[model samples]
Target: MKLKLCVSNTDVLLSTLSAIQPLRKLCVLRFTPVHLCIISMALNEPQAWCKISQEVFPLYEVESIRDNVLCVETNIDPLINALRNFDKSNSDGLSIRLQRRPVANEGPESSKKNRSMAVLSLIYTEHVSMASSRSYSFKIPVKVLKAEIDQGIVEPQLTHAEVLMKLDRDILPLFRRIERYKRSGYICVTGTNRGRLELSIEEDSRKVQLSWKEFLQVQQLEGETQQQSQFSTQDQDMPHSVQIKLKDWRLGAKLTELCYKVVMIISENHALVLHCILNEDETAEVTYYIGGKIQDQE
Candidate 1:
């Protein structure tokens, strides 16, 4: 099996991966004709599922023995370290290739147990200086598991949230303040049809609420007309809110450095979803879902 792709903006892609590095140690990278996706799942309570996407890369040439899609599991730290050499400004382009290689055996008796190994190679180059090019490769082992294991984890339906709105300013500062006070807390989000939204953190004695008036207009998701109408009638008095862990909410803060705008969805005690756009064209998006603390109320 062989797969190769050329990346136009290495900085954007690397920054995207850096955001996911803290979520989990192991990341499952998937490549298809359409997009390159990275999926990571955190352990224990208040678990999170993050998917980072690059819709249109420079290239997506694949040659596989089995199927068109290729999946590989690799350590996130090593991959991130390998990509640190690429300068965001000077780097011309990046190329990634996945292929199968034979595992080397030092002992003579080990030859009998020889097996094929999966290798991921990353090549970074500078168009101006041919001598500045460098290549880094890593052996990313693969495990055999049921294909249905990730059925419901990777791409979840976003039908849970009724109120959706886009924030005007960067939220990293707010998240930084929240992280200092509490590691985990609920994100009480309330929105109105008049394009006003408020995010608050109320835990114990600490209470902080950040409100934005006349931000971007409220966005009505598909089939959300009824909910929008309800919000309009109630004005800003009745706002849909969700309880989410502060730690999980902070996971998406790194995206603020790359994403210009953030779209937030509140499911009212079910879940909180954040869609971050990585590129100006809106072709690439990174979505994060944090399950709410209170699950019963809808």
Candidate 2:
């Protein structure tokens, strides 16, 4: 299903959002003819933005779309650090804001208390439904739908309110299940040499601070020596070219067992609690402690 949305002006919205350092948040869009407000995550990317449109518009033909701005949905947080100068590297470019409204109060009410501001609006058509039952304010554009695809209209909007409701309904139980699973000895424990372990942990952080090759190398090393055994002759020869079908990864390289003492084996997800103890003979034993998620088997 396609999601529907309305914006004040695409150009101004993108331009203003590009200027901000942290480019993630619900945007308040204002326009003539109609004014609507929307969250920033919904309009951050084309796929996401496209998903919200109920009717797709053909941009080349529609002259009125010039002032329409599409913002993100109300919940997805923006990546402050991810904001960089706009680059047309991808088919759609870096996610930029539509137009933004200052978070200030209005007249007497503004001075007394806080009021939520309008971020963006959708262009409505006669066919669009505005009933609050399940209907939304954002309408779809026709220009964005001029391609060959199934279900051209907007998909259901993953609203902030909906996400919160889902979190409370489904995700919270799943989190509790995870906790119970960890307590049941389902998780695995693993670590590399001190420096290597630190590097591996750093690589997993969402900071985009490492080069692609560097990240892959650390992941490979940590994965290979997870079991506390000496590297096989094959592993010693080409550590990078080893082939091991471990869970989700197809090992890219062979491993060289240079250091055995600090090399610990573990499941990637449950590494915090379960430990794999391997002897020099390649035989192994797994020990589980409390607190972590279980690892999925390959």
Best by lDDT: 1
Model 1 misplaced regions, further than 4 Å: 42-56, 65-67, 86-94, 106-117, 123-138, 142-153, 170-180, 221-237, 295-298
What is residue 81's positional error in candidate 1, in angstroms?
1.3
Which parts of model 2 are misplaced by more than 4 Å?
Answer: 1-105, 108-118, 123-186, 189-232, 235-298
Write down the lDDT of every candidate, Cα atoms only.
Answer: 0.62, 0.24
TM-score computed on alpha carbons, candidate 2: 0.20
Please give, for residues 1-298, the per-residue lDDT of candidate 2 as tens digits. Answer: 1123333223333322332213234332221123222222232221111111212112211123333332223322232112221121121222222223344445775643322222322322222244432212222112121222212223333211100000012122322332322112111222222212111111232321111221111224433454433545324322111111222110100001111111223333322211222223322222212222333468
Q: What value of lDDT does candidate 1 attain over all alpha carbons? A: 0.62
Which residue pairs clash in candidate 1?
Answer: 185-246
